[model samples]
Structure formats: structure tokens, C-alpha cells
Target: MASAIPLTRADMKRLADYAKREGVKAEVQIDDFIFRVSADHPPAKVDGSEESELDRELMEFDRKHGYR
Candidate 1:
């Protein structure tokens, strides 16, 4: 399991400053290259196609069973 690290006030300030100066996002997220305080890329997108397909299949099954 990966451990979590708390960001200090200075770190938050730097990130906020960078975001404001660069016109990036206001969202503060720790990515793979965490603690950059000035990372140029946005956070990676999470893929949920498999989960969505499973949900659709489950919905279809429920409809077939008159449970929907």
C-alpha cells in the first residue's frame, strides 16, 4: 500500500501561486510526480469502461428479471 504525505503551508502556497500564475486549474491533486508544486500536466484520467459495462449488464439482467 502506498502511504500518504501531508502538504505543508508553503507547498500549498506555491501550488496556488503556480496555478494562478500559469492559469492552470485550481484543483490541488497529487499525481505520480507528486510535490512538483508546479507540474504542467493535469491529473491522469481514471478509466471506468469495464465498470460501466458491468453496470449496464447488471441493469439488463435486472430488467430481464422484472426487478427494475
Candidate 2:
């Protein structure tokens, strides 16, 4: 039995376009899409300022408690 795709036309179009561009079939790829959406992916970088703060925090943490 064929399953119904719950995605909207625009979403399917975007998926189809992306799949075509990447040379992949857009056939029932909802699982992969859902997995990617559900995963705990990292946040995107906006500015370079966060890098320095992160580095400083990491160094302070290491100094406070020795690195394993």
C-alpha cells in the first residue's frame, strides 16, 4: 500500500528540488528529514564574538578542574 505524504506542496517541491540538485530520489524521504529535524543539532554561528567567550570559558573550566 502506498502511504500518504503529509508534507505540503511547497515542502515537497523544495524537497524534490533539493533531491534533484543532489542527485537523490525524493521518494518517501520523510524519515531522513524527520531525523534531521529531531536531532540535537548545534546552533548556527551568527558573529565571531562567541568564539572568544567560549574559548575563555573552556580555559577557565580547565583551570578550575584539570582536564581528563
Candidate 3:
């Protein structure tokens, strides 16, 4: 298991400043100093045809039951 690291006020301020300067949003994880910065935009939509294993199985079941 990973240990969590506490961030000081200065550290948080610096990170916030950097994120603001870069014009992105920061997602910080305390357990692993992982920062995920993304632009302030809508997330991309997934294609409808890209089905997961569970989705495929459910579709097969539906077809067998003539529920389509």
C-alpha cells in the first residue's frame, strides 16, 4: 500500500499558481503525488460501438430473449 504525503500551505499555493499559469485544472492525489492536469473543456464522448465485455454479454442475452 502507498503512504500519503501531507502538503504544506506553500506547496499547495505553488501548485495552484502553476496550474493557473498553465491554464489547466489540477487533480492532486495525496497518496502518490500524482497530478492530472486537464483543460477546462467537456470530456470526449465514447463511441457507441465500443462495447465492454459485460455489455456484449448483456446484448447477447437480450438478443436470445428477443428483447431487441
Clashing pairs for predicted structure model 2, backbone only: none
lDDT of 3 by residue, 1-68 (tens): 75555776677778777777787788788665765555455577977677576699999999999999
Q: Cα lDDT of all candidates, in order?
A: 0.73, 0.63, 0.74
Query: Root-mean-square deviation of each candidate, in angstroms?
Result: 12.0, 9.7, 9.6
Stretches off by above 4 angstroms in model 2 are: 1-45
The whole-model C-alpha lDDT of candidate 3 against the native structure comes to 0.74
Ranking by TM-score: 3, 1, 2
Per-residue alpha-carbon lDDT of candidate 1 for residues 1-68, written as tens digits (9 for 90 to 100): 77666677787788778886886765555665355444467677866998899999999999999998
Q: Which stretches of candidate 1 lie over 4 Å from their true place?
A: 1-5, 26-68
Candidate 2: residue 6 Cα off by (Å)? 23
lDDT of 2 by residue, 1-68 (tens): 66566687787677667765665554554553431122233577677688888988999999889873
Clashes of each: 0, 0, 0
- Highest lDDT against the true fold, candidate: 3
TM-score preference between candidates 2 and 3, better one: 3
By summed lDDT, the worst window of 10 consecutive residues in model 2 runs over 32-41
**Model 3 spans > 4 angstroms off:** 1-5, 32-68
